[model samples]
Target: MSDAQTDPPRQRRERKQNADKRRRQVLDATYRSIVSNGLQRTTLATVAAEAGLSQGVAVFYFKSKKGLLSEALRDLYLIYEAHWQEAVEAAGDDPAAQLVALVKADFDPKICNPAILSVWFAFWGEQKFTPQYGEITREFDDNRQRAIQGICARMLPDDPEHAADVADWVDTLTDGYWQNLHLFPASYSNRRACNSTLRALAALMPEYRDQLTPAD
Candidate 1:
């Protein structure tokens, strides 16, 4: 018999909520551990210690280090995807506004902080050895690319090839900015990176230059 079957409805709801809270705590600790210790050095014990939970509890929730790390990657992707999706939605139906929103979303503090970037690169560094990491990252990349491509297509209806190319360039530009921000934080600000990306986008698609002007 399951715990839910034996427990009262209120008790079951509380139990599930508590379980979710603990699980999220573990994942947050996992990100900190990755940022502080690197991916290979992060152990279940370390994460549990960081979360103020037991190693056994970590195992119970995630089964193994691989399971824990995979879920962490998925969680990060979900956070990233949600930010961009919300940005696009808030930009209304204008493709230009949506494109700008998507670009700006990459620099949002919640998704682009040093700890999150560290965790992301840590997973990316292990993609060759970890197939699931590659799978998760590929999905992330594909989804973003499709969104960019769709927006570009809407803005440049007669030139589908150019739309695709601009989408690819925008993705690459955002990635380059992330790499620089991660490695050269002392010299780079998110503002500069975002403005530079917008400039590059305007140069690529001069038709949208008015709409793609970098905010001051």
Candidate 2:
């Protein structure tokens, strides 16, 4: 009832909001720094500068360089996963359409923007040295593979093994696209990559192609 007690509660709420804001700012700054300078050159000071905060402030939220990097990678994974989910949903009830949507989603510039792509490569480059990086990368890979497998299974129920084969095929194609995008810009245009993936999927399920339509 007293001013002191009420003030403490109000202050706590304000602090919580401020902390959340700061955490987001730090994560975003870390992402941008990794995108611009590559993860090897990204530092707390550099990220802090990007966030318009002091290095101490960045450390206050993330604790250490490794912690900052991990959180940034987690954020990136979450965003990527969400995009995949949306793509799956947009595919509607048709399994064939869903497969196409899945392939198209990967190359969508809105979802796989340059910054996100750069940060992804940076994380991939660091996975060799960081155990957590490997763990997170595997988690993403497994989840994606499973999702693709599930879609294939629904589309080709009569051939369960074919579903897995499709999943593996798509995975390989996706990786190839990523590599080409990183290495050869002209050869891996987004439209070309997406179309290639769709064609590959169509080849895998030629019988279902006529039934499938472009996802809304």
Candidate 3:
């Protein structure tokens, strides 16, 4: 194909790339706005300004404020899903190590830093906003819980019921630790938050705590 024939495709590709870039720019701005202004006050105009674009651009992509917020929530959930999936895969075949990797992934500052957690709590505190968001977490957590439960069962073959309970306990403790991070970030840095979860995991399964904790 000559340049004349190929130029149109190139132009189309550039437009698509710019559109994707803008979409992410707007979403990131939305998150920053929510963090700075609180979700209730984060207007589309504010998001556009934060993104260094006009409100018309944001409207062009998301159509409305709800759409932008919904996409942000979906992106957040996908990020968390990827982190844990990679962690589990990297743990090789040891169920104990895999479980520990899963726990550590939850508190990884790259994905679950205080700023990010605050953004999540903003969406979580507003039930009205949640309905607008997709159900990305439902199946994600279900599959994760099942994976952990199966790992626990394997580790404690003699006591399957206790293993099941251990899985549930770990998730509950994880939630508590997350809540602590959101509710008390000054006192509970991501490191501290993760350690709290690890400590609880230790108390629950002492046999694998050493494997879970890294050597200094």
**Judged by TM-score, which candidate is best?**
1
Kindly report which residue pairs in candidate 2 clash with one another.
none
Per-residue lDDT, model 2, residue 169, is: 93
lDDT of 1 by residue, 21-121 (tens): 99999999999999888999999999999999999999999999999999999999998899899999999999999999998999988788788889888
Q: What is the alpha-carbon lDDT for the whole of candidate 1?
A: 0.92
Ranking by TM-score: 1, 2, 3
Better of 2 and 3 by lDDT: 3
- Rate residue 194 of model 3 by lDDT: 71
Q: Which stretches of candidate 3 lie over 4 Å from their true place?
A: 1-8, 213-216
Q: Against the true structure, whose lDDT is highest?
A: 1
Writing each residue's lDDT as its tens digit, candidate 3 over 114-137 gives: 788889888878854565543655
- Candidate 1: Cα lDDT at 110: 79
The Cα local distance difference test for each model comes to 0.92, 0.82, 0.83
| TM-score against native, each model | 0.97, 0.88, 0.86
What's the TM for model 2? Answer: 0.88
